[model samples]
Target: MIIEGVKLMFVGMTTVLLFLSLMILLIQFVSFLTRDATARELEAIQKERELQSLKRKKKKEASADSDEDIAVIAAAIAAFEAERFART
Candidate 1:
């Protein structure tokens, strides 16, 4: 009975090892087949990120310009009110 148990354990371990090795080999093969496609996809993703960053920078610059415009308008309005009050 002890011998039978040892044999069973050996067979089970060997089977598991073989299955894991085969799975690793299959994954490597698939990756090898798709390597070029994956590289292109990575490049596309990087380009998209760069474009998004540029868009964000442009938006920030535009908002900064608008903030300056708003400040100038506010100053003009304040000057006009002060002049009117002085005349009154």
Candidate 2:
């Protein structure tokens, strides 16, 4: 009786193992079929990220340049006014 029970347990285990293996293979095959689509999606995502980063960098640089230009203009105007007052 014990031997029969052991045999039954092994059979059930083997059947489950085989089913799991088949499922894994099917999943892999599906993934392989969609590989190109997945790669394209990944590439597009990477490109979008790069573009966003570049845009952010440009905005920062433009703001910094504007600040510097404002400071330089203010200094030049102050110097001109000081010279005009001295002449008077």
Q: What is residue 42's positional error in candidate 1, in angstroms?
A: 0.4
> Candidate 2: lDDT over CA atoms?
1.00
lDDT of 2 by residue, 16-67 (tens): 9999999999999999999999999999999999999999999999999999
Question: Using Cα atoms with residue i matched to residue i, what is each candidate's TM-score against the true structure?
Answer: 0.94, 0.68
Global Cα RMSD, each model: 0.9, 3.7
- Runs in model 2 lying further than 4 Å from the true structure: 69-88
**What lDDT is reached at residue 50 by model 1?**
100
Mark the regions of model 1 whose C-alpha exceeds 4 Å error after superposition.
Answer: none
* Candidate 1 worst ten-residue window by lDDT: 79-88
The candidate that achieves the highest TM-score relative to the unseen native structure:
1
In terms of lDDT, model 1 sits at 1.00
Model 1 Cα lDDT, one tens digit per residue, 1-88: 9999999999999999999999999999999999999999999999999999999999999999999999999999999999999999
